[model samples]
Target chain A: MSPAKHPQRPGGRSARVRDAVYTAVGQLMGEGRPDRLTIPMVAQRAEVNPTSVYRRWGDIDTLLEEVSVAALTREGDEPPDTGSISGDLTQWAQIIVDDITRPQRTRYLRAMVSAREAVESCPCWEQRRGQAKDMLARGIERGEVAPTEHQVLDHVIAPLYHHVVFGLPTDRAYAERLVGDVLAMARPADKA
Target chain B: MSPAKHPQRPGGRSARVRDAVYTAVGQLMGEGRPDRLTIPMVAQRAEVNPTSVYRRWGDIDTLLEEVSVAALTREGDEPPDTGSISGDLTQWAQIIVDDITRPQRTRYLRAMVSAREAVESCPCWEQRRGQAKDMLARGIERGEVAPTEHQVLDHVIAPLYHHVVFGLPTDRAYAERLVGDVLAMARPADKA
Candidate 1:
């Protein structure tokens, strides 16, 4: 027998379930014990059948990875374009510092790192690299000399994440300093 | 009655037990499933009573932290003194990359980081800072411009660790580039 025809709906049941599961995971992560997060707990909080979550994500680690990637690389988020590379990077760095230093976000970041196996690539880092590439391209178009995206990742992003992971002070001032250091790399001989 | 006077032998029973426990932890971590590590498992591997392990270290996480710190900051280890800051940094960075990139060492590092709760001051970082300070002092005495110890940590050490934690490539060439970049920060205006 043929199935009954139905109109395709935007934000359908699947999308609604995904959003609920994501929100539940965020709440569990926000509770500051990512170690205790489990699929059943997420499913219960998400108000979906446990089988549905298991069928969708398969495991808690996969769920955490997906939620963390979404939280870290907010959809449609744009890098700051402040006319100058230094200003743009400074603002961007500050934004990162502020976001990751929050207790819940810190827990989420750490959970993501901890849950990871020996992987060749990190989606969050790749997203940041793409953003950095866009920012650098804009700076170059504006006739400003700039460090490569890798330089920005290694110098600015790496240090920030390092500090966050290691419980170091990740204040706005530290973010500004990291931005200044990377910018200084683009013009070395001027001061020497 | 007075206790019998035994010669206080260095590397005595207590030391031997600690060494065994540390070795066991290292071996378990090397197996690539840090989440499966338990005090009883470590005790069984160390051939020590589980009670003894519990009484001494209290928990697996604490034991992991101690073992990681000892392994990461080798006993009596010294930073390279290559007679120039650049050379010293390059050598030191390479040593770090080589040590931390080993599968076992990488697992140990990730275990340590994953076991951590939010707290101020990482002992391993403080030890590196001390080493960097000594290296910087020698460079200043040699009349070579040098970035501050904090700068060295933020640039070289932080990035290396960040890469290790994130499953990024951490090789000798990457280490050398990081050293070069940090040194360049010490002389910014000379390029333009």
Candidate 2:
């Protein structure tokens, strides 16, 4: 197994360096797909010694993992749920649309993709995607979604990452409409 | 730009070389993700000289562009309209699920990702995804999908690619159920 990856500490001399590296990596990812990301450029962008950045993250792949986790984790408060499927989904969809449209989130997605490729055996995406599944499950329990809700989680919310990372624009209104449509589609086949 | 990618070819030696190279690239993609793929192994698989393969394709990235085009083109046989949203989506979703679940398709996704990263400034993915979009659009036009269709296209269909390409064991049933749920969710807010 690969050695466990850790972030540079978030304070003092190390924090300054870590911030620079991540910021640089984000810029590179925003400008191009993950394959084009280079350590030299990342070091240049972050204003850290190339060797130091490499030593800390080990390679582009690991650096990307940190960036992706940070990106998903950094998004601000979710909109309040309206206690109805349409309201809940509309709010969630809008949040996703906003996140992907931001330059940083797309970059993080590209990086996470590279990391997934680099680590062939690990199921690292679960950490990133699990929260979403849990949220959908909550909706299911509240009767806002079907009991068998994993499919909705898999099909709808997750696809936004693929689109954003690939540099596609996913609009907000379209997102809301889709949420409404999907919730409707999931109704039991027998119920009209 | 970039010598006009995938320009139409005259028949003979160039065609033969192109065929051999793409087949080799596709085979390697079928085997595993990009990190695990090697040029020499692709050469061996194609039964062509390694130098010839490299000389012709220039590297894995260019070869991948060709393969991505080929793979995506194979998508979307016409679905029976069946006069209902669920029936149409069920058919289309099944096709996608079945195609992606195959071992070879998994390899192709992994390789295409590597290729996507390596090619710094190409919009090839737009071409690949456009096919799915067009297919979904057709469904929308036929009134087999809801008015807010692109969102459904994004969340439902796009996520399937993410799951399968990332080595998840997703299947057609899962896709159908998700599509169904999304359709249900699409109902007018007041009605829902």
Query: Model 1, stretches more than 4 Å misplaced?
Result: A1-9, A36-41, A44-62, A188-192, B1-9, B36-62, B188-192
The DockQ leader among the candidates is 1
Q: Model 2 off-target regions past 4 Å?
A: A1-17, A30-33, A36-60, A77-79, A82-85, A120-152, A166-169, A186-192, B1-21, B24-66, B73-104, B110-156, B166-173, B176-192
Top lDDT model: 1
- Tell me candidate 2's interface RMSD: 5.1
For residues B53-110, write the lDDT of model 2, one tens digit per residue: 6766778667666666677556643444555666666776777788777767755665
Among all windows of ten consecutive residues in candidate 1 chain A, which has the lowest summed lDDT?
A: A1-10
lDDT tens readout by residue for model 1, A109-133 = 7777677673456778888999999
C-alpha RMSD over true interface residues, each candidate: 2.6, 5.1
Q: Going through the candidates in order, what fraction of the true interface contacts does each contain?
A: 0.64, 0.38
* Candidate 2 global lDDT: 0.61
What TM-score goes with each of the models?
Answer: 0.85, 0.60
Q: What lDDT score belongs to each candidate, Candidate 1 first? A: 0.82, 0.61
Model 2, position B96: C-alpha lDDT score: 72
